[model samples]
Target: MLRIFVIVIIANAAMAQVPFLGTCPNLEAMQNFELERYLGKWYEVERYFAWFEFGGKCVTANYSLNENASVKILNKQISSLTGVATSIEGIARLIGRSDDPKLTVTFPSLPLPFDAPYWVLDTDYISYAVVWSCTNLGVLNVRNVWILTREPKPSVAVVEKAYQIIDKNNISRAYFIRTDQKNCPVTN
Candidate 1:
């Protein structure tokens, strides 16, 4: 009896997913729409909040574009104490943008964890920011967003540029914490 009850609870949790289920909020109607061109190793320019293991340290998200299936991510880990680098393996797949102009990507499964991450690409070719939304409802939107670039460390201009893009979206800049950058990446 106990086992059955536990299973039911788990199943219910999985059913409850982030808002919009599979759609981007606000600025949904953009001009061009392409996912492949946007996939690449983007440097962390400015982030709303230190996400994952990068609470206080500078963090970078290394994404390699693949044609096979899921996109792999080496979310570099930085040690705030000693200023070191570590890498973790993760996958991202377009979940919500299936039939819309916007898109959101998550790890493997969706909802079950109740933290399905969705990113809406702003208007830009090289620079792009993803508004990390856990639920479809904007009322509960928190600081889980990210701004990335092709380079490891962005120039002050680029950083500001990204910030402007995010700012235009109604996101608060004060809440955003810089990703761990003790070990900055090399640029092209």
Candidate 2:
């Protein structure tokens, strides 16, 4: 009995550090995804807690075409406590097919040695986007999800639509936390 109790405690501790457990869900990426339409800025409305983005508010991601045909990604966030802004640049390359919404993103500034998956589960270029990434580690998985909108503060209808899409995919909305977009500092 004590051995079983110890095992359960260890499992819970491990899961507390990661985003999700069990095998990564088999979610589908957006079909016929158009990179051109997805370019420009997207404000994060909600997201799973990410260690890299701790204490960040008014998070936004901007994408543009690079000279080498890869997509250039710029993610900016303001410190909720300090009111200072910070940004990071990364490069994303299409993983398989040209139209696939799956890409590998590499942040050269970070200590990570390998590229991470950036998968678009669903998006309506003019309104909202759902991005998901998961890395399976044997018994547990590290998952990240972001609900993005073209506008910093999206309308209720828009948010409901995004939530409906997430529901269709059976992704839990429990772990997501809202990102503060009010009174954010303006940027060039």
Candidate 3:
């Protein structure tokens, strides 16, 4: 009985993963914090979507602040299929946090659209970039993800750090897939 109880506790502990929605480790607060600050454009540095690699080719993002106080996000995923580059566009809206400085994002076009909510988990004012995740994205499907600054892939240390944040926040991590575009290491 004692051993079974201990196993259950350990199993629960292992399954509790989340993202860090707190402030940056070295920075005090985000810069140009207005929703406009999140506007303009962004590229997928790394994501957790496996079936989509929906990456590769050339991926870019565009955003505009909407009148409803939502960030109008336009994500274009360009990938080569059988030597032809194809693109898929997606629209994401901020669901949680309007003034708290944090944002939880959701896509209204995908199959499970509103299900895998992407949270603008955290960021650093100094780096001009941010970290994002979905506590339910991965667990729900094979399309959970994260977006970042540019085309260049993140460093090993950065990946570990992001994992740490997710570990502490109970974010989903299943079926996570890192891309292999011009910016990432060759992981087959």
Looking at model 2, the pairs that clash are none
Candidate 1 vs 2: which has more TM-score: 2
lDDT of 3 by residue, 67-173 (tens): 76666666555455544444444444544455444555556656544433444555442223445433422223122446465334556665666566556555556
Candidate 3 regions with alpha-carbon error over 4 angstroms = 1-34, 50-57, 88-91, 101-116, 125-143, 151-164, 167-176, 183-188
Residue 179 deviation, candidate 2, in Å? 0.2
Better of 2 and 3 by lDDT: 2
Cα TM-score per model: 0.64, 0.88, 0.52
- The candidate scoring highest on TM-score is 2
Question: What value of lDDT does candidate 1 attain over all alpha carbons?
Answer: 0.53
The most accurate candidate by lDDT is 2
Per-residue CA lDDT of model 2 for 61-114, tens digit only, reads: 999999888999999999998999999999999998889999998899976445
Candidate lDDT (C-alpha), each: 0.53, 0.86, 0.48
What's the true lDDT of residue 183 in model 2?
Answer: 91
By TM-score, highest first, what's the ranking? 2, 1, 3
Q: Which portions of model 2 miss their true places by more than 4 Å?
A: 1-18
